[model samples]
Every structure is written in C-alpha cells, then in structure tokens.
Target: MIDWARLQGVYGPAHDVPTLLQAAGNGAKEAWDELWIQLWHQGNTCDAGIAALPALASLAQHTNRAVRFPAIELAGEIVGAGLREGRPLEKMKELHQPVAMLSALADGWLSERPAGYRVCFRAKLALDGFPVLSDVLDDFLDFCCDVSCPQCSDKVSIVIGDFGCYSSIRDWNLGDVHPIPLRPAAPDDLQDAAQGLHHAAIRDEQPRLAWGLRHVFGDAECGTCDTAFSVLSALEAKRSPSTEFQENAGAATAPAGHDEGKNRHWPAPPF
Candidate 1:
C-alpha cells in the first residue's frame, strides 16, 4: 500500500514492488535478500526499503517466526539506522518516511489488528542490538561461544570493509579471545558441548542452552573462561549474543560481556 513513487534509493526507483510482495508472500529468500540489500545497504539508507515498508509490514501474517522475525527486523533496522544518522540533510530525508511509516503501522496493528504484527515488533527492535545488547547479552554470548565464521575475515577488497563478526568478537574479548583453535570446532561443535552439559546433575538447574555450554571448551569447562556454565543461567535460555550482535548491529561498542569483565581472557567469556 506504500506509494513506492515517494521513495528513492541509489537506484532510480523500486521497480519490483509487486514482484517483491508476491515473492515474500511465498517466503522467497531471494525476495528477502534483495529487499535487505536495497533498503538497508549493509546498514545504511533505504530508498527502496522505505517504499516497500507497507508490503513488508504485512508480513506479520507470516506463520514462520524464523522468516517473519528476520523480515520485521529489517524494518526495525531501517528505523534504528535513521535514528543513528540523525541530522544531515541527506540522511534525514532517507530515514524520515520509514520511521514515520513504522509508527503508523504500529498504531494500526496494535488497535484494530489480530494477535500477530505488533506481537514482537518492539521486542524484535530491542533484540536488533541497535544501540546496545546488554539485555540479550546471554544470547549473544551463547552465539559467539557456538559459531565460528572464518569467512567473516575474508573481506580484503577495497570497497568491502569486512570488520563485522570477527571484529566484534575481538572487541568483546579485548583481543584476548579467539575461537579455541579447534579444527572442526564450529557452531555444531559447541552444540555437542551443549548436549553434554545436559546431564541430570545440571539439567534442572540451568537453561537447556546453559547445560549444553557446560563443556564448551572441550571435555570440560575451560578453566581460563570466566563464563561459567552456571553464569549463563542468570539470564534467559537459548540466547545467542554473537548472533544477536549480528542481527541487531549498529553500534561498534561491545555489550557488557556476560562474564562481567572477570573473564578478560580470549573466547573464554563466551564459554
């Protein structure tokens, strides 16, 4: 329902509005990717994305949380980005409409709508990690503990400044953390660790994720790691801090380490 003509991006106009709507309705990943790239060019302006807001907003109807959360998140990111870019003629123009549109949608969805669109809207924005991520600190930490994207460091091109996942890990650990040089120790490996921690002894005491992270280092908790399997339980379960950082990223500042600064040692904070 958005007047696509009102918005403009680096490209002329959003020509694929109808196609994108149909594609997203069908849960097309291509549509999602294209929309993200166009609207939030790696966390920037959203000429096309701004225009596509109405169609994207309608996605609250999506039954799939995985798909719906990410899509709605894209809308949140646009607003967050605009907020950060406050002032400056060009940035303001780029953000104004999308931010306003988001508000309008929230009002409409909250009052006359079903139990869907407005459900996770604000929460999703919070989790996006726009300003900071201390709330979902547990989730972000868990994700860092689990996954290792080596490819994240491969951005050697001039235009492509690849200082994202890997950089965040570095800052969080204060350059002391790096994935425990495990040859095959990726996210799945940590999942195995998580599985081991799921014994009857600690089963009732910790979140399911905390139980799995008990032995994240190897056969046991890494002694150097300040993040005890027990500590993670202080927060909610299944939180992936690293992934949260990736999901709702705008700030370069790292969140408070789940280890509470006791574990200044490398990758140990995530353990």
Candidate 2:
C-alpha cells in the first residue's frame, strides 16, 4: 500500500509545494512507480485515489518546466484513464481543485515573464483541458488578448481557436476576453516561411523545394496549376506516398473560397 505516512512525512510543514514539485520532476518515474505500487497494493478506493492528488498536482507546478509539463500531462492521462474504468466521477472532481491551483500558477508565470512562450503554451493547454477552472480560463484568455507580440498573439489565437472549437463546444464566449485582429503578414512572412521550411526539412529530411510546397499549398491543388508539382519540387528528389493527402485533410486547412464574412463574429483560426 502507499505509505501515506511517508508522503505526509515528506510533506512536513517545512517543505513547500514548489520544492516537492521539483523533487517529483527530477525523479518522476521513481515517484510515480512508488505511487502505482501503493495503489496496486491498496486496491482502488476513493480515499487512496484522492490522496495521490496533491502530489500529482504539486508536480504540475514544478520549478523545472520539463518536470512541470509532463506532470500536468500525466494528471490529464490518469484522470482520463481512470474515468474510463467506471471510477467515481467525484474522485476525479477532487482533482480539479489542485489542477485549478496549478493553472493559476501558470498564469502568474506568464504574467511575470511574457517571453516564456513554452510556459504560456503549456498553461493554455492545461486550462483548455480543464474547463472546471473557469477563473484560470478567464485569466489566460485575458493574457492572450492583451499580449502585443505577434508570436504571442498567434499562440493565443491558436489556443482560443482550439478551446473555442473543441473544448468549449462552439462556445465562442469562452474566447471573449481578447478580441485582437490578426496582424497582416509583413515582409518577414517569406523569411518566416523559409525558416519554417528549413526546420521541417531538417526534421523530416525532405527536399527544400518539396517542404516549401507542402508548407505553402498543402493538399489544395490549384485548379489551374498543379499545386502538387510545386510541393513535389520542394521535396527535391524524395518521394513519399500521397495516399494520406486529401483536399482539406485537416481542420487546420482553410476551406476553398471560405467566406469569413458569413460569421458576424468569427473566432480567429487556431494557428
């Protein structure tokens, strides 16, 4: 069984949440292994499940971003898997309090250091998955709306679009806080595109020309011209099956001749 006494002992009055989270991140596998061992021996019970909540939540706010990111991710995984097993929803509800607390911490991190894109991104991701934390949602959306940098704004737009579409179930109000229009592409657009192509080429080992086409035209073959030709050229000599490529294959793809004016207040596209 989990050594409740040991966990409580480690959580003695002197050790703060941040410290414990750091420890958990540095030794997550070990810590989680212990937790699982305890859970397996103790049997699945409400109290036992609830007791693990605090430690897991603490890890979500670890000082090390690497540790904190995975901890938050793991919490989501555990809750999702546990819920599927017919576990009591109330036990999962108990986890919300801590998750919300971590969300607030993430908000603080973003506010204090706006350049920490990774932190802001992960925070948005966490809040998107945990709708019960309405307060965190409010703060995060507000931050996205107010942040002036295009990169930051893009991230915000992406998060707002994603949450608005998937998590909030078409509830645009969830994205009401920031109402900034997307900035027009500047001369830097080509540079940014080239850079994106370079990164993709490096990561996927595709030809520069093919990568460019895939980045630009995607699956929409220009009716007048072979858009696929351009994409294939960017790929250089590399050849891959196009079986998975479909016209407008992913939600990220813009609809052909899409009318933006149709919606009175269209939420911006998630980047």
**lDDT leader:** 1
C-alpha TM-scores of all predictions = 0.38, 0.31
Tens digits of per-residue lDDT for model 2, 1-271? 3454434322132223334444566865665544443332221223343455566677666677666655554444344333333455444565668756655554454444344433343333333342111111221221121111222211111122222221111124333333322222222343443343334334433343222222332211222221222221222212221221222123231222334455524454322
lDDT tens digits, residues 38-91, model 1?
Answer: 676654655565455555656744676445555556766655454344423234
Model 1 regions more than 4 Å off = 10-12, 87-123, 126-271
The runs of at least 3 residues in candidate 2 whose Cα sits more than 4 Å from the true structure, single-residue gaps closed, are: 1-51, 80-96, 109-271
Candidate 2 local distance difference test against the native: 0.35
Summing lDDT over every window of 10 consecutive residues in candidate 1, give the lowest-scoring window. 155-164
